[model samples]
Target: MPARVFVALMVTDSGALTAAELAQTLRVSPAAVSGAVRYLTRLHLVIREREPGSRRDIFRVRDEAWQDALANRDALLAQYSGSFAEGVSVVGRETPAGRRLTEAMEFFEFLRKELDGLMDRWRAHRDAPRPDGPPA
Candidate 1:
């Protein structure tokens, strides 16, 4: 349901919707929309805000939602790397299981570092001058 709502917001011409609007557009009940929005907001996928000059809340797909989501995983990657490294020590480095854990830890650490480089490359690509010139 959250994925549905995210996609709906992405494809909307207005780029924002009220819960009632989402409910109507997706043919779902208000309760379902409520639950989906709650989950999405926690993940920073959709931002909740008030309509101009009104008290009603509006939901919109965040401009950097994908980049933000990917970037947010750094801590999680570090957590996994730490946990796996601990497991290697617990099992003794000479054992097969310890070797496996070491490999896994290294993989996650590599991902954490590569993710930083990947984001940098993405920023460079995004900011690079266009050969055809700026949009009209």
Candidate 2:
């Protein structure tokens, strides 16, 4: 999969790779690589860049890929919670189905709030000095 290829590149010393290079490394077709890159690009997990003095389009994972991915879930959470709330209203608050929807909506709302706090804590931790030593 393209995600696996991206992870491979991340673990390797070479942090970026051309489509052909990625296909070769992953034993997949160039078209597969392209599709993967396109998906990742849309999700803001990967970026496309030109190799200086070359025409090759290199694909590399963004530095904040994880953070961006996690943050993007807020929109999905909000949509799910909204839909659940609507379901509860349609089913009537006293019904079992309505209670289930209410529980789900509450859970999602809690997660949405916690996600914001978690991201903030992560940023602080990321910026904090390392007592052990510099990062590898």
* Tens-digit per-residue lDDT, 39-127, candidate 1: 99888889999999999999999988888889989989999999998999899877999999999999999999999999999888878
The per-residue C-alpha lDDT of model 2 at residue 63 equals: 85
Question: Cα lDDT of all candidates, in order?
Answer: 0.92, 0.88
When superposed on Cα atoms, how far off is each prediction in RMSD?
1.6, 1.7
Model 1: residues with Cα > 4 Å off, grouped in runs: none
Q: How accurate is candidate 1 locally (lDDT)?
A: 0.92
* Model 1 residue 98 distance off true place after TM-score fit, in angstroms: 1.0
Q: Which ten residues in a row are the worst by lDDT in model 1?
A: 127-136
TM-score of 2: 0.90
